[model samples]
Target: MRQLVTVSCVLLLAVSGFAQEDSSQPRPFVEIAEQDVKPSVQAIAPIDDTNVFFLNKRGQAGVAKFSPGLSLIGWELYSKVKLNSLNSLGMGPNYSLVTASPIEITQAFDTAGDGSLDFFQGLVRDWQGRDNGVRITAGPVADSNGRLLFALSPFSIEEGQPPLARLVAWHPDSEGLQTVTESQLLISSFSVGPDSLLAARLSMPAYTEGYYISLTGLPSFLADSPDAVPDPLPKTLPSLLIPAELTGGKEPTQMCFFGENNQTKLVLTCPESNQLIEIVPEKSGSQWQGAILLRSQTPSSIESVVEMNSGLLLGGGPDGFFPLEIPAEAFRIESVNIAKDGIVLNFSEEVDRFQGVKPDSYTVKAVSLRGDNKTLMVEPVIESDGKTVILKTSEIGKGVVLRVVCQNLPSADGDALFNKTVFYTIHES
Candidate 1:
């Protein structure tokens, strides 16, 4: 390792906390304190809520101090790997950092403890798939134990070979990687949900050009050798969305959970769209399913995300860093519950009770698998709580996706509803 260029962590926190606050003009974001790392930033990982480390397209790794403002205390060139880009970053065991590139997964260590991540090790390298031009997508996702999972895809599939992608697992103590699940639809952007069934975002060309948000009852592979690519996940994906509006454009490539200890959210970052989408994951029985809502558009692209202890959100993209705040209640749908009769709509804020009782304020439609659609005029009932509106009707079908749009439902707090549309996938009971 090159002689470490160090910055003391003690001074970083102190300086970072002194971020000058301005109250005259109120904004949701924390103080602006990021220094641009110009080479197309791909991912970010928090050493803690107060500090972060970032990787760029040029394969350069750097550290920044953030509380209020971001201060680039130090950075390092990392390795002689000549890698073009680093796609993913995650905090590994013992405060060490993990990163993924097209060719390898590496871990960085601040062994000397001078606040510089000085030591580098290729934890999983010479991966077999790289020969076919492997691209590591999501992960370095840590389980309750310290083991890691990576989603991988190889671009060049030879004729007669399985046209497949994979979810690979690597143990820190082991010398190699193992196949977690190999599939024609191996997800590179997501993983198992609360039900332990893998819930993933699948690129569905059949639906147009967008991703098919999926919940699967697929079986994981028994861990095998590095070269052992396993069976493909069943093609009859226990999925949602009968092709809907998820066509023509792409969904975000990266996803993260933010807003810790409060309202946690799964935020998906799309650098191209300059928008972060929050996907609602709902589990019915053994299947995990849900919808994707355009959360908020950013001033800059966001490729990675993390939430600070102070509840402020931070995002990093191709152009560098951005300070962000969670989507205001006005720009969110607090929750969507499907009822046997109709559907219950929940607002993030106290919505006007009068509008909740108006059938004219609601537009309901159901799309069945046979390309059949049914429109409904529901009998609306405002619940005891002003935050929820219950619409009752058996007009919606059991096997169709119900799309509910609550229009003219103004909030009592004078906040306009940012999104009135919700898609509820009704699976076979």
Candidate 2:
């Protein structure tokens, strides 16, 4: 009887060791099940590599820790602000977290390093309830200098005044807020790149309901002077007017900047296409221009996207949290540059040649706000590079938005194009 009992103890110990080893191994991040992530997440920010911070509509902020088996496992609510809705969240220097609402920007501190932001201190309420009838619209991005920058647009306007919108910044080291720029167009969302190159998403909700994305070179003088009157950004990036065809039915919730200073790029989520949109900023002789193209797509609708410390993308949606993976030779139109004859279509992936050379693969439409829409038949000629397709036509017009429907275009890897359409605003050629 003693020998049998001793054998049972050894077997029990062996099973327990195996279970612990299996649970300790980290699981693949991409395999995060829908049930694992929180629902109705308004904004998501990476607190660190192993933890993700998220906010909800009820002004509740929480930290989710990534664990061995369950991805982003622990959901701990430690801070709650007075704002009804949290628009965006950012990781700041010398602070645990920073959040923006329609009314104010709040800073929190997790002094214990336990993901519990115990101290709620410092509120920037430079604007009042009816102060100029303006509210924070889009961002409160923490730039490299640790200054919190955001945009403000008027909720009410005096007749003939043309609602005033402003871009403002507040540094942690200073008591006075600096005014970046004051413009007539509503500055919806914005981010500052290397050397104060501002990439802003603007909208005119009252008059036209028009949404525009601008990549403008911030005036060098404004960088030094806090009170310098700046040039309107619409006159700078010249503003890419987004059309209904490009919007995929809803305006983008937020935009993010990534890559180096010279190769800086913008990425935003398109819920309708279930893809990410990339905007490449270009500068020539004091003028700023850029092109918008489709990027990668995930299985879920990603909103409130934030960059990870390791250069990865993490977003939340109704489905859950997921990583934006670099797909295998993902076919997409990388640029839509103006051509002498018509427009140039640049693809990120090498074309299959057979289907890419077909003119029917692209349907071009010249759209104007004046109720004139014309269809231009494309003559596709694949360039020698195997990815650039030149569409020869004479219909490219100024003040027009080109809606190009890409169909049956596949990459060399036999993958279909990620997005179906590309909208480009043409100001020249």
Candidate 3:
């Protein structure tokens, strides 16, 4: 298999030279199963290469100790609420030490297969009420060393109330949720990277446009400082930022981080085409200096960044009541497009593996039209270059509608996320 690049593709612009055209070529796409990946999780938290954890919608969480080969050493129910949304989930230092509201906000674990979750814990939650148009949030931050920090927002339920959002360092070796206080501009979307934390705050309000990205509390910046300040130490990374805009004056959807650190990318999708966008870190720094790599109007969106490790992520648009199943920042789909031949599809790190497949992954299928009065149906063969799946059609004919789907294939660990499906039409050139 060829080692592909680390960039994620967006379908906004006309992607040329993607499908190497050949009349009688060796089938470019093939249909095959994937290998078994343990710690079957829809929500993944990566810690180095040895430790990681996964959480499911039912609130079930498990830990994996991997030395390339993972062993499910521990499992538990870390939350009390039903984890219905895939994007409204996250992980921190450890499961037991953090306290997230609604009982099921989010938790974290190690991926390097280490027994210790770096001796830290993470908690996250959003607030909602009938009268109060507010959303409260919180989480924890842990470094390679034994230092731990707590992130909290003191109830944003009412207008005119001071936003008490800040990051505080809590010494587990000491006691209580007290210690150094670190505050910064309120953030709407953020995620911890391999060596730093990536965050974004709306420049104005949700009903408006524009936002800023920044990184806080990285060791590289704190190396020279003798005393750690009581505020978010910003990391200056310019190429890893995004500014969301709603065209035609449409309300912007919320965003959330699908997974903490690296190992997982973000995703967002809608029923309609061209409704989402994905983001990634282009570089590392101390302030908002990154660029939004890919932008589009496709209904499906994926982060242009890929974690060359183990993990998964999922997110989508509002279903009516809530602002989509997941938060806007988590895994928002940046865009979607009908193939030149009119084939619709979905792809992300959230899909699972197959029992009989070489690599644990998902599959896409084509559907029929006229309810049942069908004439011809085509299928897709799935192939990969170690990164994304490449699908080859059986053959195309006139007046045919193909439905492509990414079904959840079972893995050694278990089922991960729901399979996605898209439809396409074929016409004569």
Q: If scored against the real structure, what TM-score would every candidate get?
A: 0.74, 0.74, 0.37
In angstroms, the error of model 1 at 426 is 2.2
Of 2 and 3, the candidate ahead on lDDT is 2
RMSD of each: 10.7, 15.1, 20.9
Residue lDDT tens for model 2, 172-228: 434345556656577767777767788777765653443577776665443454443
Q: Count the backbone clashes (under 3 Å) in each candidate.
A: 1, 0, 80
lDDT of each: 0.60, 0.64, 0.33
Clashing pairs for model 2 are: none
lDDT of 1 by residue, 1-429 (tens): 111112133234236653222234322222223344443567677666666667776666665665455434334433333344445677775556777666566766655544455666655665554655677766666543345777677332355676666666665343456555555664657644332345455665555534555555444433443233345433325366523342215455766655433444466776776776665666677555565565666888777776555566678876666776655555356667777866877777777776767888889888775768889778988777777788899876666777778777788766667767677777666
> In angstroms, how far off is 110's CA in candidate 1?
4.0
Error of 1 at 397 (Å): 2.8
Q: Candidate 3 lDDT, tens digit per residue, 1-429?
A: 011111112121125443222223222211122324322343344444444444444434434343343323334333334433332233432233332332223333332223333222122222223124322243333444444433444333246755444433333232222323223344333445545453433223543333344444354424334234434434222222232332223322233344434322333321233344343333223232211222234333322111214433222222110111233323222222344442323333322223223222334333232333332232332334211333434343434334443344432334332223333333222
Error of 1 at 50 (Å): 1.4
For model 2, the run of ten residues with the poorest summed lDDT: 1-10
Q: By descending TM-score, how would the candidates be arranged?
A: 2, 1, 3
